[model samples]
Target: MSPNRATTIAIGVGAVLLTSVAGYAVWFDYRRQTDKDFRRKIRKQNKKVSKVVEAENSAKGARTQQDLISAIIEISQEPTPTTPEESEKYFMENVAIGEKLSTLGPDAYVHAATSFYRALRIYPAPAELMQIYEKTVLPPVFAIVKELIGIANVIAQQSSRPAEAGIDGGEGEEDEEAMIAALQAAVAGAGRE
Candidate 1:
């Protein structure tokens, strides 16, 4: 065979091998990227499913507002006092009801708010008591009330929508904001009195 022909054949073989290797690398990279994306999507879906299951489990054991109120009333059976010192003591004893209700999550906010309001009703109107009320009791009550308002707004929006459009239509952002503003105003008014 001629040297020139042998050299040409060698060049052709080298080119074919290089092209095959490049093609295989590109295909492998594409497959790897696709697999990574699929795994990420599956992880996200699993997280969503787990959250739904957790909510369901929690709801199974959740207590109603009436149940909470009844429990509070049962625990707080002390007679109403006429003296300021006794009233302060009574308020201090029942303050834990608000804290407990606050821990019950947003579903129990109405009950929590009611408990706080009741505590305030019997509280002595002295200046020192007012400071304690504002500093200690008001924040958790306000927070629970705010959460209740938000939940109510969400429910109202969901109920008002057409069933075909799905439960949470994502159109209640504005309504939620307006409701929050209203709740803040109402809470502030209640706090002043």
Candidate 2:
């Protein structure tokens, strides 16, 4: 082969090798960065989970009825102002209280119900307080917890049934009307009580 042709072929092969190495290096760095980011995110999430678990455990250990009642009171007294900020604050505060309430077990629910009924007696029968309790607070408190270790099918079957029979997912405007009527009836019943 001519020296010129040989030199040209050598140059071409070296360029190809250099390009391949550069491409692989770039890809490797990109993968490493993505993996690092993913690991950092996972660690952050794990810390949050640990915090929640710690809080739940501490709350369960305390088991103070006063704490439960106080949380409930905080939830109930959120301002009913017409402003968006007021409404958002109310929702956020209630969500925090709800999370705390979930940490408390079944006994806490009974106490909550008793406390609610007692408050109902004092609050001049069927007030906004009672309405909130019936609609927002009571349903979640009364939710039944099932421990499913090995019973996957059983859990699936149980979950399929709606807690309230009259309510179905596919109903449209008629469902809304029915819900309103039910609420009105509930308010009337509470007033009578």
Mind giving the per-residue lDDT tens digits that candidate 2 earns over 1-193?
Answer: 9999999999999999999999999987787677987678767999999999999987763443233333333433443446667655554554455445545866556444444433333343436654565466646453311011112222233226534423353456786445334333333344366
Off by over 4 Å in 2: 1-79, 110-193
Supply every candidate's count of residue pairs whose N, Cα or C atoms clash at under 3 angstroms: 0, 0
For each candidate, give its TM-score against the true structure.
Answer: 0.32, 0.21
What lDDT score belongs to each candidate, Candidate 1 first?
Answer: 0.57, 0.49
Candidate 1 per-residue lDDT over residues 6-117, each given as its tens digit: 9999999999999999999998778767898866876799999999999987675243322332333333344566898877776765566766877787666556665664
Instruction: Summing lDDT over every window of 10 consecutive residues in candidate 2, give the lowest-scoring window.
Output: 144-153
Candidate 1 regions with alpha-carbon error over 4 angstroms: 1-33, 36-48, 51-61, 64-67, 72-78, 83-85, 92-118, 124-134, 137-193
